[model samples]
Target: MDKYAIIKIGSTQYKIHEGDTLTVDNQNGKVDAEVLLFSDGKTTILGDPTVKDAHVKIKITGAVRGEKIVVGRFKSKSRYRKGRGYRDTLSELLIEKIELGGKKATEEKSIDEAPKKAVEAKPIKAEKKVSKKEPAKKVVKIKKPVKKGTK
Candidate 1:
């Protein structure tokens, strides 16, 4: 069973696991997030606002901009119209590990582990070109039958 926890960053709450990446409201400097709840699949711990001695370690990766939002205002019979667009500044965070009951669950690999090598890129082959030709049309001429006495 995997371990999971509910944590609060700013005013938002997120359910996260070790090694997960999160995008939330911009955090100035370091963030001291609070752990709301925690579960280790077998055991569950609840907090009255926050858990005691439990910690969730996170690293701020970078800052990002959220999707643009358009805001508009219009007043009837006033000939007044306004429109604007803006994006919220957001921050990206990586969950490093979670600690509970003096035990730590780490998502990062140890320095003794060997690093993986990058795979070599394969060359792309050119596609075969095809020429399209229009098919010939057959024309059939229909002759009206001659009237009995007229040619």
Candidate 2:
């Protein structure tokens, strides 16, 4: 099947296929930039902006200035005029691949490589020596000397 993808070149949307080199106003990076987006026929939405789960990729070609256009402002009666350069910055894209659903960001680990066993949390017990601790105070005992005469 002749699969065509809709991708955003820069500020504009473009319908392109493999090995197609396209230009846009400006892109995120220079030539051979890594980009990924979802593509079909109806729309080529910005995956990052709308759907974070979307998958798409692209490569940058080069950055160049477009044709300069003269912009003039003139008043018919007052005779006032001004001119300015209008060379727009643009970038090129070499459509690498369009992932319709999303990029295979990750893969499931094999059954043999199960998740690491969680650390067995033991109850924290302060191991203080009770026998070494001394009592707060010592008590003294006094006895009366009447035991000898009472018998």
Candidate 3:
């Protein structure tokens, strides 16, 4: 509930907030490009460290250059000393808000489709056939006199 932002500048992700300035390792975006940061793609788990696709508002403070270094290739007595100034393009950002995206979509759909789902008149009652089981009848036995001799 404490308003925070998940911002992605280039391939690096940052968790930032209002007035909280942070530097990204790389800078490959415009000053204000809509970038969505997520704990994961599913849009759940804010502080799960994995983050979601929730787009946050940011104002790129400015792009800064890093330090300098020397990049020279020369022989010992050949006298070759080449120094170069290299500054990395670092972007500073201030996190504004972690937009609540799904809230509106879900709320709108639920409200609009509620009546449609309820009023979709199905059959009032289902007609099912019921068969009765009957018990099997036994045959009656009749006693017969056996012939004593070879009649």
Q: Best candidate, TM-score-wise?
A: 1
lDDT of 2 by residue, 1-151 (tens): 5546544433455666777888776765643222344445566555454445443355777888899999989999998998887898888767766555544323225568867898999999999877776768968789877756564
Per-residue lDDT over 1-151 for candidate 1, one digit per residue giving the tens place of the 0 to 100 score: 8899999988899999999999999988677788899888998899998987578889899999999999999999999999999999999999988888664332336889988999999999999999988999999999999878756
TM-score of 3: 0.43
Question: Can you give the TM-score per candidate against the true fold?
Answer: 0.63, 0.47, 0.43
Residue ranges of candidate 1 with Cα displaced over 4 Å: 77-79, 103-151
After aligning candidate 2 to the native by TM-score, how far in Å is the CA of 131 from where it should be? Answer: 55
Model 3 has how many clashing residue pairs? 8
Better of 1 and 3 by lDDT: 1
Between candidates 1 and 3, which one is better according to TM-score? 1
Query: Residue 130, candidate 1: how far off, in angstroms?
Result: 93
Q: After superposition, how far is residue 70 of candidate 2 from its true place, in Å?
A: 1.4
Please estimate how well model 1 matches the true structure, expressed as its whole-model Cα lDDT.
0.87
Q: lDDT of each prediction vs. the true structure?
A: 0.87, 0.60, 0.56
Q: After aligning candidate 3 to the native by TM-score, how far in Å is the CA of 9 from where it should be?
A: 1.6
Model 2: CA > 4 A from native: 9-11, 30-54, 77-79, 101-151
